[model samples]
Target: MIIPVIMAGGSGTRLWPLSRTAFPKQFIALTSNLTMLQETAARLDGLSGDDGISPMVICNEEHRFLVAEQMRQQKLTPSILLEPAGRNTAPAIGLAAIKAVEDAKLASASNELTEFPVLLVLAADHVIEDVEAFQQCVKSLLPEVQAGKFGTLGIVPTEPATGYGYIKATTSSGRLGRVSEFVEKPDAETAARYVAEGYLWNSGMFLIRADRYLEELKNFRLDIYDACVKSMASTQLDLDFVRIDKEAFEACPDESVDYAVMEPLAAKGEVVVAPLDAGWSDVGSWSALWEIADKDAQGNVMAGQDEKNFILQGSENCYVYGSAGNDGSGRLIATLGVENLVIVDTPDALLVANKDKVQDIKKIVSQIKASG
Candidate 1:
């Protein structure tokens, strides 16, 4: 069985105005008609394993309704796991692994079936343009996962980007290779060098056996494993949502899956990487949104209700994201001779910044919170 676990607990402060604390990037329809969460679930249309395929979503407690509603729109009834607090990916994934094991055992007992589930861990806010290519990448990693080795998709770097972490593969061989090391986000020069060396952008997508992940997490980060087990022991299922104990999860350490598990495993040469060349973007910033967005002849992306609503006068390489008549009334947004700018207009906030500095937009969000 291939169990897809969608991690959807990020605030996405970098994409401030439109992506707020209440409604983050994952819930927004950034690139397509479907929201990013919907797209994530929809992209798994044709995938199946030996047993079967079902998605298990881990999201913020506050956004449980939003996640359920979005998945419901796509006619998908995924098992929603609610995190009472933001304990990061390590604990989040641990919870999923624990649940998967428990569920598999129950199925085996009830139906008299032997089942082993392989988890396909995906981020909810990624923009993978080529669904076929993405599916192929997952197919390529299945063998490694089935072979009892931890596997993750490593994106073939199209550019020297400093925003994402890099994965150093042991050998630049075929579609799959042993992961050498995982590096932190680097400076410009370091990123360029990594690109030259054929390092991949760590896509944060994992394919591993449910039991194996739990065993490994128990081995490497026992504290996280214990907390997740305790949290799951007290899990309460409310309709379509599985709510973990808040106080127990709050006491769990805040760490990423990479820091707690993948890194340590990679260091021991137990991790494998599948190189994915699909057009994948984390959609972490406004500039990232511009990169994936469809643009005009002058390298400008003007998003609104109609062409007439947004008049770009000699603007080159600019991104304007807003909706005319968004809330039943219209607002015409015009740009005059502005080059390389990002203008985002939302109901409560408006943001304007240089395209190059969009990565630092999180600073503005921090200031806003400070003022309040």
Candidate 2:
């Protein structure tokens, strides 16, 4: 059995006004008609058999309804796990692993099931253009994971991007490679060097047996493992959501799966990398969304409720987002003789920033909070 765990917790402050703390990027339709969370769940359509269980989503209490509503839109009944507070990826995944183990055990006791569940950990905000290739890459990693090896999807680098971390593969045969090392985000020169040496971007996607992940977590980070086990012990199901123990989960240390498990396992030759060449983007900033969106002949990407919301004259390489209110009424924005700028108009805020400075929009959000 394959259990999909979608990690949907993020502040998404980088995308600022459109993506707020209460409403983050994952719940927004930044890339397509469906929300990013829906897209992530929809991508697993045929990969799991008809008898397969729905995906498990781990998110904070604030966005529980958002997550539920998005999944409900796709007609998917996901096992929504609600965290009391943000504890990063390690504990988030630990909660999912614990729940999966409990459910599997219950199913085994009632039926003649013999196979254990394998977790396909995916982030909710990634944009993978080629769903077929993405699913195939995930399926390819199953054999190695079933053979007692931790597997992660490493993206074949298309450029020397300094924003993402890199994974060095020691040996390669076809799509599978032995994970040699995991490196942090590097400077331009170092990123170029990594790309030249054939390093892959760490996509943060993983495939591993549920029990194996719990075992490894216990071996490496006992504090996290113990806290998760305790929290799951008192899980209460509240209207299709599994609520963990608040105090217990808040006591868990905050850390990512990379530092807690993957890196250490890579050194022990227990981790494998499946190179994925699918067109993938994290959409970390406004510029990234512009790069992937369809543009007009004038090199402008405009998004709004209607085509008349924005008018461009002699504008090139600009991204303009005009958001409307509940009644579908918004101000008409006109741009003239502008290039390489991002203009976002919301009900409460309006942002007109140079394209190169979009990465620093978080600072603006910080200043706004400071002023209040």
Candidate 3:
């Protein structure tokens, strides 16, 4: 059985103003009428080969309706697990795995136990154009996934991008070698060196058996395992979501799955990588959005409206929205003199910032939260 787990709890601060606190980038119709979360779910629909199974989603409580409603839009009735609070990927995945295992146990009248589910964990905000290639990538890993290996998919890097983390891999005798190392997002010089060395972008997509992942989590950082166990044990089925115990989950560390599990599992588990060159993007910044946007001859990406004459001028590689001023949904956003800038307009505010320093938008988000 293949169980898909979609993690949808990111604060898309880099896409601020247009993507606000109440409704983040994942739920906003940025590139198309479909939101990022909707696109993510639809991508899975394209992976319908080799008897793919139903998907289950895990998200923070605040995003419960957003994730569920998006899935519903696609006509996919997915089971959702809402974390009472954010405890990162490890605990989130753990809760989903626990539920999958429990549901697997209530055997059908035929008394046939289901195959240990192979979890295909994906982020809800990633952009991948070649849906065919993405599905092929998943199918290619099925053999290894069934062989009890903790499988991962790696996106072929298109550039020496300093914004993305890299994965070093070696192949021998037609078999993918172990994960050499999980490197952090490097500086410009380091990124160039890594690209020259043929490192792949770590796409954060994993394929692991429900039981094997839990076993490894138990063996490693027992702190995570203990907290997840308590949380899942106290989980309740509410409406369509499995609500994990908040008090127990809040006690769990806020470490990411990369830092808490995957980094270490590179040595402990048989971590293997599958190459995916499907025009993937995390949409981490304004520049990334432009890279994936439809561009004109002058390299101008005008999405959502006629952007030939932005409210300002001299602006190239900028994203502009003209939501109304009364509600911040339809305001003219023309630039007279700007270049490499990002202008995102929403009902409550307008964000104008340089493209390069987009990562700092999180600081502004933190400040807003503190003030509120």
Candidate 4:
């Protein structure tokens, strides 16, 4: 059985104004009619086996209701786990791994059969246009993961994108390749070189046996493993949410899965990479959304409640988003003689930036926070 673990704790500060602290992009419907969280859960509908259980979502206490409501919309009764503080991906995943092992042990005891659950780790905010291909890629990696190999999905780079880190595979031929090295995000020239040399984008998705992951966590990051075990030692169920010990989780260190686990495993050749060619994007910025969205003949993408909410005159390669008002009406946004621009208009804030400069939106967000 495979237990899907959805990591849904992200601030999404880059896509700010539209994506705020109260409601992040994971809970928004940027690419489809369903919310991103809903879409993430929906895509797993046909992939699970007969004994597959519902997904387990890891989110913060603030977004507990949002996670529950969105999962309810999909008619999925997921085990919602709430973190008291923001500890990075390593600790977050550790908590889920511990919980999966516990659940598997309980099932084993009741059924009088040994059951080991493999975890399909996924991010809550990603856009994959080819769902079938993604599912196929995941299915292909299951056998290796069930055999105790840590599997990571690597996106086939369509372009020289410097925004994401890269993974160097030992061989790019078969269904699985030994992960040789994990490199940080590079400059444009380095990114181009990486693409030319066939490096895959680190998709932050994984498939591993629950017990295997816990063993690894104990091997390398013993501190994190201990803290997570302590946190889960006193897990309390509140309705649909699972609450951990706040003080115990707060003592955990801040680290990502790559730095704490995958990197070390890759060095030992225990990590395998599965190349995924599905059209996938993290939707980190407005430009990324524009690249995947439907565009007019003049290369303008407009998103709003009504079709007449925006007008573009001689604007090429621009993205304009007009948020709706509380009364179900949208404010008009018109752009004239502009090229390569992103204009986002919301009720409380507005963002106007060049397409090439969208990566620097975090700097602007920091400035706003400092002023307040």
Model number with the top TM-score: 4
The TM-score that candidate 3 achieves is: 0.91
Better of 1 and 2 by lDDT: 2
Q: Kindly list the per-residue Cα lDDT of model 2 for residues 75-175, writing each as its tens digit.
A: 88999999989999999999999888878777886644267789999999999988888888888889889888999999988889877888999754456
What's the residue-level lDDT of 18 in candidate 2?
A: 94
For candidate 3, what is the lDDT? 0.77
Candidate 4 achieves a global lDDT of 0.90
Q: Write the per-residue lDDT of candidate 4 for residues 74-135, one digit (tens) a residue.
A: 88899999999889898999999998988877777574327778999999999998998888
Error of 4 at 155 (Å): 0.8
Q: What lDDT is obtained when candidate 1 is compared to the true structure?
A: 0.87
Global lDDT scores for all candidate models = 0.87, 0.89, 0.77, 0.90
Kindly report which residue stretches of model 4 are placed more than 4 angstroms away from their true locations once superposed. 49-52, 110-113
How big is the positional error of residue 230 in model 3, measured in Å on the Cα after superposition? Answer: 1.2
Say which prediction, candidate 2 or candidate 3, comes out ahead on TM-score: 2
Tens-place lDDT digits, model 3, residues 258-352: 76767787765478887888899998777788888886555666665555434555656666655644443454666765677767765667677
CA shift at 54, candidate 4, in angstroms? Answer: 0.9
TM-score of each: 0.96, 0.96, 0.91, 0.97
